[model samples]
Target: MNHLKIRSQFKYVQHKIEAIDKESFRYNYNVIEGDALMNTLEKISYETKFVAGSDGGSICKSSSKYHAIGDIEIKEEDIKVGKEKALGLFKAVEGYLLANPDAYN
Candidate 1:
């Protein structure tokens, strides 16, 4: 497994890569020190698999699970915001890959 740390003005995030291969990747992240800590967001786990598409491209299948601290329930709106941010990140990566065809090959 690989570990990464990201620091921003408002948050300190940690990422752990649990598994990776040609077809699948899995990881977990947590905001160790941030505004989210005050809100009880503990961690998030994600898994993504790539499969061959009918059109000779690769299709991505992904899932995310969120964890909350103790008995505090995560709000629906917060979950939606998280999902939207994840989608935006994915789209940005896709755009970069499309622009740089040889990247990560």
Candidate 2:
């Protein structure tokens, strides 16, 4: 089996995204702060790539024993839509990794 994870961290005005591989214990994909990180993420094909942010914040769940991204905004009023978008985006990435395990190998 293959394990792919996406972890997100958010502060007052900043957010972070980390891509990890559980099978190989490798966590190297990091989306840094600023528009550059946004640009980098744009290059990747993920379902959540097009989620626009609202005036409020989003929520993210904490990391689990198998898969988790850390604490983030998942609530839309508090950012519920954003949370859904991020999850969708990560899910797409997970699908890609599962379909092409050799790409990581």
Q: Each candidate: RMSD to true structure?
A: 5.4, 14.8
* Model 2, global lDDT: 0.42
Best by TM-score: 1
Q: What would the per-residue lDDT of candidate 1 be over residues 1-105, giving only the tens digit for each residue?
A: 222233334455556676677434433334344564456867677777777799998788878777777888878897787777768768877887787767657
lDDT of 2 by residue, 1-48 (tens): 555565445332233445555554434333334442222232221112
**What's the alpha carbon RMSD for model 1?**
5.4
lDDT of 1: 0.66
> Which candidate should be chosen as best, given lDDT against the real structure?
1
- Global lDDT scores for all candidate models: 0.66, 0.42
Model 2 per-residue lDDT at 104: 82
